[model samples]
Target: MEFNEIIERIVKSTNLSAEVLNSKINDKIAELDNLVSKEGAAHIIANELGVNLIDSDASQDFVNIKNLVGGLRNVIVLGKVTDTFPVTTFEKDGKKKQVGSLSLNDGTGFARVVFWDDSINIFKNIKENDIIKVINAYVKENKFGKLELHVSYRTKVRVNPDDIDPKSINATDKQSKAEFVDIVEIKPDSFVKCFGAIVQVYKKNIFFNVCPQCGKSIKSDEGLSMCSEHGKVSPSRKMFVTFVLDDGTGTIRCTSFGRDAEVIMGMPTIEAIKLADSHEDSTFPVDSIKSKILGKEVFIYGRTSLNTFTNSIEIITSRIVENIDYNVELKRIAEEVEFGDKN
Candidate 1:
């Protein structure tokens, strides 16, 4: 039998009562399986054992804070919901009212918990620094792709203002541990490293024909790129980069927009515009943008937004480091370029 199986069997045969030993043994088995799957099992065991499970492995679920929050379907976290502050909203019925969001945080991370209508009353009564336990909450993405956690009809939430210290609650710090070791906490605006490869580079002047109906680029009959679907409609000039990065949990998209694109890609605004213009009617080579960052692992620090619709992050405040410490791969690339020159 495997080591865990042996332990489970041995723990079972012990003179100790089955209730005490079985609960713990089963929980251990569940934990060994994977972190995300163990949550429910661990929570159940915690109830029976009267002990909190700390720092198991959120790596599986938290690929990136934004991506994880965006992709989460049904999840449980030990956190608190912020009391109502102030909110304003316009209703579909042509009515407008001030509303507030219940910000939920377990000290490790936070999510905006929206309360509407009658639910607003319950939230308004909550005081700041209150500790709340949340379960069965669903993750939704905002317009900007930031993940916001919501309390569904089936969500189970427990609120206790006096028993918990909003600040004292220890949370798992996945990123920002290396460089910011001196910092006791990860602030919202603090910078964190993101890893990914540059899959695309866009310049505002580069023109590519896209389908008017789907917004997908298509080859124009004129030999110049034009959205034949739109027939006479003008093509848009915008730069977009798609990159894949992993945070020891899972791989996610890292995007840069507008000015951020110029800074990260080292392309001046006017130059980028000119490049876009040259490619406007045809598929331009991604060389200028691609050569700067191709298969290399680049590090970026910026704001991450969770795309709820696509279940990914749209990294905005991003800047790239051309030369990183991962030298072994770069050296190989250097050799390859040298050989190509010789040919």
Candidate 2:
């Protein structure tokens, strides 16, 4: 957290003027023989008044930003506020829903946090470089293939505390061991990191109906398209792509949805849907998807699940990176499997 955030927090929490707090902070620094910075001095004064700085429990399993992946919940992250964007509003269910996004960096890497509805107000006055702590956050991947933290109903926002040392939070040793596992070792509903060749691309119902409101696929009941929660709705077409991944040990189908599907298609899903609709063959982009994605070794990070229709377990990849360096991947595989002497 920066000194500005401390000062702002102090003023907001105590109804004190910035000028008065600045003067007292300077005085405390002088009294302490210039031993502490302005922020440190302000913290001392706040402590003397029996006030808390940032409300974070030190016991939290706060990891570096780069370690964040999807399927994580109740995450506690401690990072400096690096960037903040303007709040934007969009209509949802006839009411304006406001959202805001900001970047938090812990020197290891930066992760974005999106504040929804009421959470946006917490960072409305936040400034760049303000040290921040997010409590009970959730992780999800955005459209652009980046993992992000989201402020939820249980989320709490805290500012800088005196106990934290920025130097101690350096990124030198915090890189993730989060690469893909071998294809044969995948388990149900677990996010697996693995790289394998796209041996085949499955051709089935690659497109489906989706409810606009909740964004889940709408089920067809007779002639009526319906959502389980929001019934009798107009539906939109969505992409549901599946492909085979081979890691020598075994092959498993990898599924991707929506934004990830769009990425694989190299075009917006809606555009693909339109092309499919216009074409008499109804197999639009099949050749293109096969040409680009198949016969390639791609890195995948996604959850594994059993496809009910096929009764076979498959990986649902959230993100895929193509044309990985073979030497580095082999090293990671060796470390994970202890493949050398096996002593």
Candidate 3:
């Protein structure tokens, strides 16, 4: 789990305000002297969350916040709900599934608790600054190589009895965190990261006429055109390019338009359309545009959607990074985590 994941999980699980919680966490960390102490102390707002560490005489094991690691199963922990991320819904096998998580902290350290599917409802009721105990939760690393808890149907989430009402923490800090994700995991999420190589480019209908006002495909009436949705209108040319991206495991057909398509074509949409229109009767500059992208590498920050007509996933490219080495970027991230080390 990343720091934002930790911060988000806490903000959502308790009634505490995110703005206040962020401020309090940052202020606590700023007071610490060294990296290790700063990291550990940053988690537990002792008076704010009212969490305590306990041990039983039995042989059963319980992990601490700072000791959390990836790939741990049947793990249990007791912590205060610190913060939470916004709830997100995604489709899996044609059915919708919801996911949410909360940041949990004992005095020793901090961790993220993720809720999935039906389990997400329980976490939904949990508010910030609530004292909660989770049993039978599992741990895993996210795209950024940090530990987070993944709770399942078998996991137990409960609110501990307390006499006092929950209070909001000072969540005023605005530290930012971002990470790149695999292309396979791309879906209708935020501006997520994806990298792949262009396997093929489909150039037919790369540029076409659309209604200037509403952007719907137009019906040609000699010089003037008619839009089915908007009636009569002037026509404007737009780029709509389709291509294939291969990421070793699979291939996905990607469709991009306007500015993103122009990035691959190396020219403006109007210019390409004019060059094609110069021909006797050309729909688009098929051969010229295709020549620009076949077999090239690309990194796209785009939006993914499931096409109901095809019932398959497709991408709408927003930003493109042509032929950049991703391995080098990952190495740089690792170096920053190990040395500078601010969570």
Candidate 4:
């Protein structure tokens, strides 16, 4: 039987229900099992169950900035004060008051908490690596288009030495892998993906024959063409080729040749060599490329690659697919850009 069915049978046999179960205890046991598993058992099980394993969503106990919403009840969180700002005191005559901001994280996510005068004394005692509990905190959007959580007068802060144990927090901790499409949509510091075809080839350098003395790239010594750099020598001609790939949104040039290039281009050994030999300094027109790309959609993702030899940029791609809706992609890109501007 499947895992879920087995779990259900066990629960039915025991006549146990969530109302009688201790969430913290169960979470701890699961976390322990996950930690001991060969490969992230907790996350794997959570994935199989379609559960949001990580506590990524905002909670009333801990108000994380990334998931903050205006006028929402904040979360209670326990984490070390990873970073702290200086406490600035405003003075009026003989009176003085303290104020500052601090950032905390427990590897899952982060939150910046601002402290006022009364709370400054409590926060001032907070040192790096000190685990503290925050209650009744909330998040608000800052001027720079980022969310920040602050502790108000009603909020309470306390240092819990027992909670210093990482294992205790691990039992409650959760994390999720980034979604491929969401990375692009959310603009949350992600890698770029694309796909397309080879269209043209160009021979940048070639050695026709060899020199009698110096073995280097030389021009043809025959009357057909006199060597300008060399006195009188024949050199081998070097060959390189360029290929253009078309995706619905755009056509990109991926210039490569030889065995590796032929494999990706799906060209025969002889055909690949012929294309490389034709140093036609001509490129397929943009209109023709657009027409080809309009029908096919390929998938690619990678950081930009630079060609040191040719002093050009070639984007690396993978997972080529065809017949994609370019308009949908365009709309997604537009929305992501617009949303990223808010952050």
Candidate 5:
């Protein structure tokens, strides 16, 4: 339970004013040598007052995104869907399984909700901007140390529940807005936009194989392309580019995939593929296009994630904007200044 909710419960059960409850919570904090957070102190106070803050039935209460921790089971959460991804299929133990994911924001923070197997059917009905209530979910930390809410067949989902006030979800569309910031100010697990010049481009190992049907990476199996979901199939070539971007504040490594990679290369996938075929060198396409993108200025909007191997934050580009207009940029700056002055 959140601190404010706990305090509300204590006030109702023990007939204590909110101010008095806060005072006692503060005293508890000081008594513990300021080692405990206000919410922890509030929990202790609720315990001493014989007030049960946690609901006897866990599914009835919603847990705030900020309070989520790993290993939590039978958890309930309510949030606005910020993003959804395509469902992917895989084979495990001679059985096929599907997985899908979406991002949720509850005004406290954002979390990724993963659906497995039959649970993906629930995800198929979900869309961006919808308010959802998830019951009987479990929490686990991803390899990157980010908390994720996993939904299985036993979990229940309510889409835009009638009891929830849409107005109460302050972060309904907040995560969709990408704040433009300097590369130096970028943090992990955040959506951001930046304007920078491509300082360096890595030209080798630019192409990868993907299953044409589902667009997932495919592997070479005995001289045949094999997709875990599609079995043996012809694979299509996909492109990705990694480069260092500098905006005078700092430099960050940014990666662009597929169409965005083609944009950066100033060439289409077919043309690049033919170029590589002609030379019989898979690295030839990047070698041909590297000079054209060096020192090119562009705007990138994407999510930042920690690259654990590098111990640094990197951007996985969602969209890349090139050929910027100086006049439009000046007008935007003027409007921002005017709005700031009015506020």
Candidate 6:
């Protein structure tokens, strides 16, 4: 058990705020001339308060970010917030729902923490570089097969705990370089940058509805477009492109969203929308662009995930680097060769 967990247990038993308990623990530490550790002081305080700090079934402990896996429950973790995303709202079953997320790093690895509905209130108080302790949170694999920590009603989050030194928490940089890998080496839950040629394109269902205000997908409610954040409103169209990329070693399906899709199609989304309107065929935009895209070489930076229905891995492209740079490619190849030789 960690010192934070001990303090939490004492707080629960004594109905005391963590601040008050921390003050007592600090005084205890000072009274002993700094001879005892924070955990030792916490134990002494708990004993004086007549709080039972032991539990036979106490399995929850601080888990490192890298070791977290899907389907984990009652998890505890402490990490520094690296990035925070705005809260997004959507409608589900005619009710409004809000979700917010932040990226956390604990030096070992990085993970995303998702706050749902009421939990967004807690997320709102968090800021970048804040060291937060999360207790009773759950871990689940997202659609991309990446593990995410989800905060529920039972979860307790302490932001910048007094006993912890901010300097001691060294978080990994979120903008670290992505691994460069070939299509054959792509693995689920990994981000990679690869160079490939467009070999095939799926032209059907190239456009979808989105909320103009938030750019999130909007649903039809009783034949009316509804955005959870903005309520009923006019929706905008967003385009996505799906195609197969082959890098000579292997071929993998890839999907690019919005602006990235526009890059792949060689035209703006409005032009495609206009073309679709003129032809009265939604698939015509992609149909017209397919000939231009085939055999085009480009660099793809994206995340790989399993396509459950197809039982194969696919890439959700984050970026497409066009107009190939042969010099950089040669250097990357040389590095790969050197790495292989070292192995």
Pairs that collide, model 2? 1-131, 180-193, 180-194, 181-193
The candidate, 2 or 4, that scores higher on lDDT is 2
Q: Report every candidate's CA lDDT.
A: 0.49, 0.71, 0.64, 0.46, 0.81, 0.81
Q: After superposition, how far is residue 309 of candidate 2 from its true place, in Å?
A: 7.4
Q: Candidate 6, residues 121-155: lDDT per residue as tens digits?
A: 99999998899988888786533345677787778
* Per-model TM against the reference: 0.34, 0.45, 0.38, 0.33, 0.45, 0.45
Q: Which runs in model 6 stand beyond 4 Å of their true positions?
A: 1-176, 325-343
Model 4 TM-score?
A: 0.33
Over 4 Å off, model 3: 1-179, 187-191, 213-224, 227-231, 281-284, 324-343
- Compose the digit string of candidate 5's lDDT tens values, residues 1-343: 6777888889999988999999999999999999999999998998998998776755348889889987777888999997675676766567886767777888887777877667888899999889999998878653333567877655898899987887788785543678878999999999997878999998687889999999999989889999999999999999888999999999999999987787677777788889998999988987887887888877788999999999999999987655323344335435544644685
How would you encode candidate 4's per-residue C-alpha lDDT over 1-343 as one tens digit per residue?
3444434433444554533323423564576764543224333444544544344432334534345564444356666665555566665356775556665665555666667657888888887556777776655543323344567665788776553564444322211111233111323133444434333433233112444455454554346433455576544332233445554344455433333333333334444335545744222222223343333423344334556786544644322222223344335335544654685
Please count the clashing residue pairs in each candidate, in the order shown: 11, 4, 32, 34, 0, 0
Off by over 4 Å in 5: 1-176, 325-343
Error of 6 at 240 (Å): 0.3
Better of 3 and 6 by TM-score: 6
Pairs that clash in candidate 5: none
Better of 3 and 4 by TM-score: 3
User: Which residue runs does candidate 2 get wrong by more than 4 Å?
Assistant: 1-179, 187-190, 306-312, 323-343
Tens digits of per-residue lDDT for model 2, 8-88: 878887867999999999999999999999889988878876677766654336866778887577788888775565566
Using lDDT as the yardstick, the better of models 2 and 6 is 6
RMSD of each: 21.3, 18.6, 17.7, 21.0, 21.3, 19.6
